[model samples]
Target: MDSVYTDVGQARKAVEQHLARACAWVDMGGVLLVVSELVTNAQRHARGQWQLRVQAERHRVRVEVSDSVPLPPRWRPGKLDGSGGWGLRIAEQCADTLEVLTSARGKTMRAQWLHPGRTGVAVA
Candidate 1:
């Protein structure tokens, strides 16, 4: 599923709906966390339209968030006062593999979670 959203809440809702139809293979909570973090980052930093693409299979689900900012996301030390800077770390921990691709126009943050027994293997 692919969707474009200018609002963070809308992006979260769209991802929730897409995951509802996927098979019970991947960890939904982890995926949702990753999606939320990525989308929230785009909204807070990119400050414009963003696109979300979700691909689910029997053993894995890949979530990609594309925004109009060419700058890649950075990790800053977490603060005790919750003054920001933890989303990337949380997303990385929740996903099996997290990658960032940058272009002149924008960047895409891709997070994928593999089923417990299917790590590093392709699903047939």
Candidate 2:
């Protein structure tokens, strides 16, 4: 699924729905959270409307968030230990593979999570 939304809140809801239908509801929430952070970062830093794409492969669930800014994302210290603000770090922990690519049009952040059956077994 691919979508472009100017509103971050709407984009978040759309991502949640897409993931929920693609996977388990609870698992979707986690994916949605990561998607939300990516989208939020794009909106806050990028100059134009962001784009999102999600794909379900046999081996993994993939998400890509693209923004107009070419600069890469950075990890910064969070305000409080449990008070959020660590989106990139959290995404790195949740996603099996995460990448940031640069292009003339914009930058894209890609993240993927391995499917349990295809990956042999889920890590504890």
Candidate 3:
């Protein structure tokens, strides 16, 4: 599934719908949290629209969030007062693998999670 959203709330809702229909066996909370962080970062840092693509298979799910900014997100230490700086860390912990690809026009954050007992290798 592919969608573009200018609003954070809408992006979140789209993820929820995709999860329900395509990835019911995956961890809902983890996917939601990762989506929220990436989408929120796109809005807050890129200050423009963002696109979300979700690919669900029998043994894995991949989420990609693209934005107009070429810079990748930074990882900062968590704050005690909850002022800021924990999104990337949390997302990394939840996803099996996370990658960032950047170009002159934009960047894409790709996160993937494998179903339990599924190894991180292609079966072809």
Candidate 4:
């Protein structure tokens, strides 16, 4: 979680490794997708450091991205133009729960994912 750039590959790798260690069988692709969007938004808006946290629980994987910006996200709808501005929308659709929280220092975007077998996400 560097302040300079949001490396999506690194985030994905970290999450994948964590899941592997825990022997969790959650939806890795959806978790990676949510991580990518949160990091992307943090890089685009948050003016200061952006930190990524991934936690593997007994039945869920929680991904959180904390940034310096205190303001909340626009939460815009998906675009039909195909120019590629649909990160948050895709996250909403894929993740089981995506939330935003504010703190004294900044804001955090949290996304949780469950296994496809449990939630019928069918996103293989």
lDDT of 3 at 47: 72
lDDT of 3 by residue, 23-83 (tens): 7889888988999888877767787578888888889899899888898887778899977
- Quick one: best TM-score, which candidate? 1
Query: Model 2 misses residue 40 by how many Å?
Result: 0.4
Clashes of each: 0, 0, 0, 0
- lDDT by residue for model 4 (57-97), tens: 66677888998888888866667896556888888887898
Q: What is the C-alpha lDDT of each candidate?
A: 0.81, 0.74, 0.82, 0.77
Q: Give the range where candidate 4 is weakest over 10 consecutive residues by summed lDDT.
A: 115-124
User: What CA root-mean-square deviation does each model show from the true structure?
Assistant: 2.5, 4.3, 2.5, 4.7
TM-score of each: 0.86, 0.77, 0.85, 0.80
Model 1 segments more than 4 A misplaced: 1-6, 122-124
- Clashing residue pairs in candidate 4 are none
Error of 4 at 27 (Å): 0.4
Q: Where does candidate 4 stray beyond 4 Å?
A: 4-6, 80-84, 115-124
Q: Please give, for residues 26-109, the per-residue lDDT of candidate 1 as tens digits.
A: 777888888888888887888756788888877788899998899998789989897889999999999988999999999999
Count of backbone collisions within predicted model 4: 0
Q: How does candidate 1 score on lDDT?
A: 0.81
User: Across residues 1-124, which tens digit of lDDT does each residue of candidate 2 receive?
Assistant: 2335246577667767766667652357667777888877776767546888877655678889987778787768777756556888878877877899998878999988887666674432
**Rank order (by TM-score, best first):** 1, 3, 4, 2
How many residue pairs in model 1 have overlapping backbones? Answer: 0
